[model samples]
Every structure is written in structure tokens, then in C-alpha cells.
Target: MIQTRVFPGWRVVAGAFVCMLTGYAVAYSFAAFFGPLEAEFGAQRGETSLVFSIAAFLYFLLGLPAGLVGDRVGPRPVVTGGLLIVALGLVIAAHASTLWQVYLGYSLGVGLGVGFSYVPSVTAVQHWFVRRRGTASGLAVAGIGVGTLIGAPLANALIARIGWRDTYLVLAALTVLGAGVAGLLIRRGPHFYGLEPDGEAAAAGKASPSSSGFTLAQAVRTGPFWAVYTAALLMSFGLFTPFVHLVPYVRDIGLGSGFGVLLITLLGVGSTVGRFLFASITPWLGRRLSFALMLIGAGVMLVVWSLSTSATALVFFALLFGAFYGGFVAIAPSLAADYFGGRALGAVIGALYSGVAFGALLGSPAAGYAYDFFGSYAGAILAGALLCFIAFTIMVLAPEPARWLTRRARSP
Candidate 1:
């Protein structure tokens, strides 16, 4: 049992940090496996991209139920079970001999596992910190960026040292060791341990009002929810194109071989800085404007990228664009919590991210098809920028729900 004397919510944050780090690390590492899988499967780029889309699909699509379950039961069971599934998936992928088996074991298994763990970890953080939701969420989701940083280089190193097959096996062990222990430490909220959301200090003084926001059905009924969803869909559609294709895109641009995989590293570094930077300032800037600004910044970067000629230009574009993109990801949950209130935060966030999942599913393969058809990434890059601009427009025009404003007015 966690002690009541400590801020248990921070413990939840710590646990979530590890779970996200492990889960996303494994997912992003798919890029490292990309070349190997292409050779082994003898599949087209689009087809190979489908494997990731399928995994991402199940991961996001399942958020509705997973969030609902976490809201009702607890996050621990959901997360622990998901980590176990991740381990199983990695093990299956490690030994598979066919593409279908890879789809089944690696894509389906890891996707579902990540979905289960992700919603719960993110939602759990909101429950723990009402005053600092933005900061806490930034710290939590920063794991994805950090994992990308670690996972990309680590996966490449592992693949080089052993082999892709054995690499999966090693990942399986780490997933079980790191994520499993972290998942065990996570509890839903401070209330679970007989402490308040921000621990005894805030509880003894004036506790922030729990949000009286929309339930799932009512939330879906609103225009703002759909607007946010549309923006997310568009943003994700554009953003994932770079993430999935940047490595190959680098190689395609005639950059030296040494720099192909290093793009992920550069993007990771930029995102980490962006995540922390944005989270720290969001409280002052407000969620809506901050989000809109990030989107716009990212859009401009993409536009510049379409014209980049040299490797130096691409690297600079990648770092700046990745920073803006990372900041956007960190703020998403806070935006949801801000709009909907903290009542159904888990479920609302999960539903919102469903858009991200769908976007990735549609966007990545579409980008690949563009490459196959046009023989260049220029078309796709421009399309992504267009999507980001559209999302920024919606963010500027969209109105916040009355419930959220009322809660803010009441806050001390």
C-alpha cells in the first residue's frame, strides 16, 4: 500500500512516465525494423506501412472502452494487462516467419497493449492534479518523445548487434521489466490511497473544484468536441507522415547513409525540449491559444520543408518542426480536460485520441501511396501543411464550452 504521507499522485505520475516511455519506445522503434521487414516480406512501402497503421488503429480505436473501464474499475489492471499483452506481442513477432503472423503478433498485439496502457496512464494523471494538469500531462506524454529518442537509436543498435528477430526478443524482456514494474505502481488517483488529488496540503486548504462537465454522450453531442476532433485528425494525418517516412525520406533526398536514422534522433531531441517548454508556459498562455500557435508554427515549418534542398536544411527543419509538433502532443490532454472538465477526462481524452489513431491509419499509408505514385514526398509534405493550417483555423474559430468557463470562474 502506498503511504498516505507522500503525494501519491506524483507516484502515479512517475509510474505513468515509465509506462509511456516503454510503450512508445517500442512503438517508435518500428522505424528501425522498417527496412528489415521490407526485405523479409517483399512488400511495397504502402503495404509495409499498413502493419503500423493496423497496430495504431487498434491502439486508438480501443480507447473508448479502455477509458470507460479505467474510469469504473482502476488503471492498474488495465495497464498491467496491457503490458503483458505487449510482451506477448513482441515475443510473437520475434519468432514469426510470415507477414500475416507479424500483423497478428506485432501489429495487433502491441497496438492493443499500447492502447490499453496509454489512455489509463494519461487519464490517471489528470485525476491526480487539477491545478497542474498541464505540467503533469506534459511530463507524462514527454515519455513518447523520450522513448523515440532512446528507442530509435537503441533499436538500430540492437538490430545491428544481434538481428531484428532477436531485437524483438530483447525488447520483450525490457517491456516486461520496465513497463511491468511501472504499471504495478500506478493507482487511479490519490483518493485510491485515502489522500486527496494534490495530497494533504491542497486538501487541507481550498481544493480545486472537481469539474461538472459533460458526460461521454453529451460531450460527443457538442460542436467543439467535433471541431477538436477534426483538428486532431488533420494534425495527426500530417504529423505522422513525417514520422513514418522521414527516415526513408532522408535517404531519398541523397543525404549520407549515416544521417538516415539520425533524423529520428534530431526530431526526438526537439520534441523533448518542446514538450517541456510548452507544458511550462501553457498555464500562462492558455490551452487554446497555445495549441493554435503550435499548430501554426508546425505548419510553417512543413511549408519550409517542402522547399528544403540540402541535408542541413532538412535537419534544421526537422528540429524546429518536431519541437512544435511535440508541444502540441503534450497539450492535447489539458485541452480536453479544459473543455470537458475532469469528470470523464479519461474517456474524453481517449475518444479525442481516437482521431489521432484514425489520422495515423489514413495519413501514413496515404503518404506512402503518394510516394509510390508521384516518386517524391513533395506532394505529401504540402498536403500535411494544408491540414495543419485547417486545424489552426478551427482552433481559432472554435468556442469553449460554457461548463469549462464556469469552472474556471469558480477556481481560486
Candidate 2:
């Protein structure tokens, strides 16, 4: 037997880091392609946005099913499969000559791959960590920002030098490499290793699986589920707006190409720091409170973005904004797990992301069309800020899981 005893917990956390690199970097980086893709495919700007929205729709829509598959098939194959599909999507995007072809390959194929890949990796992290859950989740998902940071600048550079198609051929190779390493390195951790849920000999203690878990049906029927999902929906709607457009928006305001690239990348830097900060702070504040605070912080940043005229101010804005947005990503799954059980955590988390899908549906095209409509990003910024406030409210009002879990633990 391949023993989970073969390695320490931190190693598994390391594996999660690699897994996210491929998923977030390549899968979500399609936003950077908007300008090139519109030109290369001879499509309208909105048509390009449609490609991202559809992919996002598939990303969210496919989460629960993929989670179910992760549970049964085990995360290994699902993750490896996702990486392979991402590579395939890249190759297909490289060869496509029409808008529909790009949509079919990129939106459908890569998007679906994200659905398959992301949760397995995330769930694996959750499965592994119990006491330091927030930190583990943060480190693992932080790859989303790091990979995104790498991909955007690299994609931009490649687009300038090699053209988008050939550039994708190179990225496809990297995608394959990323998946292979994950498959090789990430064996199921403590559970597979025959250790207890928490490490058996840790400084603190050990844990068993929660005796409580809601059936998928039961989870879907609740007020908390809808509230968290709604908040996430607004998050995706507005969050990716920055990921997809900050660079272009910077340019639109006369910062020029290089600064625009720096601005976009800066958001990623903020995201990285934000993830670490949330991981550090969540223990003190609790997951629900931390999430609410992040939402509020992000919403305020959106307002700042809407009104900025100077690059110096904008850069600072990108930093703080990136941090909190990154924090949201790291904490989200743990919050889901805290409220729900890991039993349906994947499915529920995936379902929650469907809001993100809806957000993607609206955010990308709306931003593009806003640019198309008013010749500035102001409309998009205002809309995102308003939605962020809505997300904050949803999160604030959503039921706290600790309340229920504490009651369950103490009663009888």
C-alpha cells in the first residue's frame, strides 16, 4: 500500500500549490486575451467577452458534478484529467480561425477542465488540513494569484513577440507539465496514509470526521447556502473584472502599455499578500467575519477604482484590492466546509461558484460593452462597486455555521 504515512502534511499542501498553478493561471487568464482574440478571430469585443462568460458558466455549472466525481473517482484522476484538458484547450485555441471555434475550444473545453480540476485540488487541501485549515487553504489557493500573475505577463509578452496562437502552443506544454508533476507528487495525504483527520502526533491534537453533514438536497434547501452563493456570485461578477480588465483600463486612461501590464500584475501581488493575511488573521476573527470584512474591503476598493485619476493612486488601489480579493478566494472553501461538511463541500462549493459563473457571464461582457458604450471603464467600476456592497450584505446576513456546529457539538 502507498501509505499516507510516507510524507508530512506540509508536503501535501505543497502539492496543492502546484495543482492550483495550472488551473488558475491558464484557465482564468483568458481575460488577458480579449484584445488579441478580438483581433485574431475578427470578432466583436463583446463576442470575446462571451467566450470568457461561457467558460466561467461552465466552470461554475460543472463544480458540483466534478466534486461528486472527486469524491468517488478520487482527486488524482480528476486533477490529471483537468490538466490534460487545459492543454487540449490551449492547442485548440491555438488552431481556431473563427469565433465559435474559440468558444468551443476555450469556453467549453478549458472551462470544463477548470470545473473538473479546481475542486479536486481544493478538496484535497481541505481533506488534509483540520486545525490549520485556513492557512492550508490560503497557501493552496494562493496559487490562483501567483499563476495568474505569471500567466498574464507571460501571455502579454508572448502575444507581443510570438502571436497568440503560437504562444498558446507553448502554454499548452506548460499545462501538461504542471499536471504531470501534481499527479506524481500528490498522493492522498493522512487519510490515505492511515493517519487520523488531524495529524496523530501533532502539537495540538487529532480529529475525526464531523458526525454532521447535510445531504446535497438538504444543503440546497437552506438560507445560508443561497446567501453564501449569492455573495460569491457578486464576487465573481466584480472580482474578475479587475483580473480581466485592469491592464486595459490603465491603458484606457493613458498609463500606456507597460504600466497597464504592471497594474494588472500588481493586482496579483496584492492577491498573494491578501491570501497570506487572511490565512493569518482568520483564526482570530473567524471565517465568516473575515469573509464579511474582505467583502467590505473589496467593495470599498471598487469605489476607489471608479474614481481614480492618477497611476500612483491606482497602483496603491491595486495592491490593497488584490490583497482582499485574494483573501476571499482562500477563505471561501473553508467557509463552505465550516458551514457544510466536506461530504458535500465540493459540490456545494462548486454550486456556490455558479454565482461566479453568473458573475463571469455579466462581468466580462458588461465591462467590455461599458467600454464600448461610454469609452471609459467608469460604468463598469460603478456597477462592480454596487454589486460588491450587495455581496457584503449577503455575507453579513448569511447564517454562521459555527452557531449550528457549536450547538450540535454541545447538545445531548
Candidate 3:
């Protein structure tokens, strides 16, 4: 009797999933901590929101280097080091006596930590699959939705029981244990194991030691690259505003904090579902088209969110917005892979996300400041909606890469 072993690619996907779940859970849990941190620090909404903005900005900006390094050195050491940094940041945040301390500890630490780990982990997944790339990518990033689902409420409950300071410590421990272990499971690519992508047996004539794909320099010069980058930048301006503000927004509308937490939870549930649901349909809808539709849908949802005052309306907004948001997150990498190939995908993806870093840096804080001035989030929400629409237009109008067009012209 012959025993057939499971493909190692699935293991890679599993590890990437856990890493994304743990890292993003820690990142998104800031919503649960928002009100408490504001009260504890005696800070304004803008100040409080800036912490999250800074962290988001740093992480996305650092992604370029992290991806570059991961491509060179592999993901394990980079991811493990990043997770440890997140733990340290959390520890410092737990001990914070001043708001500046929170910035120093949480903003820099968690920002840098997630930055180092996220791109590398996601990039590693791209190297492992071809046939099931969309599904695999969705599954790996679905950890983010699951993490958001678990992290926010868990933080809220823990803070209720143990206070915010101790809650940070608890999160720190969880990041170390969970993400640390997951990072170890990442391998560079299938070639390292004498296998091809999707676990196809390597044929003598077809075997390639390294992934075949565009280099960072070549990818950057393509029209599709800039289109994707521009769209990402615009979408991000609205994309993260809810994550940082939805809890507060619910409260501002006279809902209880618990209700706010519930909204965040619903967002997570929707996000998880969207990742699986959208990725499954990409083969038919096409990755680019699916992403464009989701972008427009997210924008429309923001308009609904701006007008929503009732709990029921807000619930609808959160679920649909989350689904669109999560779908795009899962699809973007696969789309990039479709255009650019996997050779230097980490760097290509990283470079594209650098646009997001700027948008995130501006978006959340701008919304917070708008609330401070206007005494409502209405203007910010509407502006976010407009940005999303513009992003959708840009994405839909963009042409395919010349290389892909040429390849198709030559194909039978």
C-alpha cells in the first residue's frame, strides 16, 4: 500500500492564516480600546485617533522593506522578529503613564511589528499556489476577519474585567504565543521542497528553481500597476476610517459601547464571509472585475453609514461594508499575481501598498479632526464615500498590462 502525503502548500496557507489572524486581530482591537484610551489619556478624538493612524501608516510604509527583506532572507525570521516586537510594544503600552508613551510603545512598536510580518506572510502565500491562488489567498487573509471578530470583543470584555492596562499585557502574550508559532510554519516557496506551485510534480523539462514573474522595476513601469496603486490609495482613505471610528460613531449616535462592539463584531463576520465568498467566485467574475465591484459597493455602503442613525441601519452598513472591504483585501494580491507574476511579488505588493500608507496616515486623523470641528462624522464619511467612487472609476478604466495583452494575443 502506498501512502500519499498532503501537499505542503496547505500547511503554508494554514501558517499564513494564523499569522494574519493574530497580527490583524491585534491591530483591529484598537477599536475596542478607543474610548478607554481617550478617557485614560484625557485626549481629544483627533489625538486618540492619531495613534491608530500612525501605526497603520508605519506598517504599510514599512511593508516595502519588509517584503524586500523577506524575499531575500525568507519569512520565518522576519515574521518572528516582527511578532516579538508587537509583544514588546504591547508591554510598553501596558506600562504607559503618558499619551506620548502610548505613541512610543504602541504606535511605533505594533506599527513596526505588523509592518514587518504582514507583507512577508502574504507574499509567501503567493509563491505556493497557482491554480487555487485566489482561494488560498482568501483563506490565509480570512485570518484577518477572524482575528477582528475575536479581538475586538475579547479586548472589550478583558478591559471590563481587568482594566485597559492589563488588557494590553494579555494581548501581548497572545501575540507572542500564537503568531510566533505560526511564523515558524512559513517556508520560502515550493521550489525549496522540490515541488512546483499547486503541488504539481516537477517535470524535468519544466522545473524552474525560482518563481517566474516580473521584477519590481518592471512591474512599476506598467500602467496597471499605477492604476492599482492609485485606486488602493484612494480606497484606503475611506477603508480604515470605520475601523478606527465606528465604535465611537455608534456611541456618538447614542448607542451604548456594547452596541458599538457588536457592530465591529458584525463587520468581522461579514469580512470573513466575503473573503471566502468572493474568492470562490473570482474564477468566473474575474479578479479585476470582482475587485472593481467591491470597491464601488464599499463606497456606496459608506454613504449609507453616513446617513444611518438606527441600530438596524448601522448593522446593515457594517455587514455590507465589511464584506466589500474584506473581498478587496483578499483579491488584490491575486490580481497582482495575475498581472506581475510571483518572482518579486512581495516587493511589488509592498510598493503598491505604500500608497495605502499615505492614505491611512491622512484618512483616520482627518476624520477625527472633522468630528472635533463639525461635532459629527457626517462630512468625513461622505468624503470617504466619494473617494471610494473615484477609486472605483480609476480601477475600472485601467487597461491590462501590455505584457498580458501581448501574451493573450499570442495564445491559442
- For TM-score, the strongest prediction is 3
Tens-digit lDDT track of model 1 for 1-412: 4655667777788888888888888888888887788889897778888778888877888887889898888899898888778888999999989888999888988899999998988888888877778778888888878887888789889998999999999999999986667776788666555555566543545444333566888889877788889888888777777667777777777884347568777778888889889878876767887888888888888888889878888889878887897899888887887788767777888898898888888888988888888898888888889989999999888775455467556999
> lDDT per prediction?
0.81, 0.78, 0.89
> lDDT: which candidate is best?
3
Worst 10 residues of 2 by lDDT: 202-211
Instruction: Give the Cα error of residue 375 in candidate 2, in Å.
Output: 2.4
The local distance difference test score of model 3 is 0.89
The collision pairs in model 2 are 4-193, 270-322, 270-323, 271-322
Candidate 2 Cα misplacement greater than 4 A, ranges: 1-8, 201-207, 210-212, 408-412
lDDT of 2 by residue, 255-368 (tens): 875776777678888898899987788888888878988888888898898888798889988899989989998998998888887666666787787778778878878888
Candidate that beats the other on lDDT, 2 or 3, i.e. the better one: 3
Which 10-residue window in model 3 sums to the lowest lDDT? 400-409
* Model 3 regions more than 4 Å off: 1-4, 207-210, 401-412
Using TM-score as the measure, what is the rank order of every candidate, best first? 3, 1, 2
Q: Candidates 1 and 3: which is better by TM-score?
A: 3
Residue 222 C-alpha lDDT in model 2: 76
TM-score of 3: 0.96
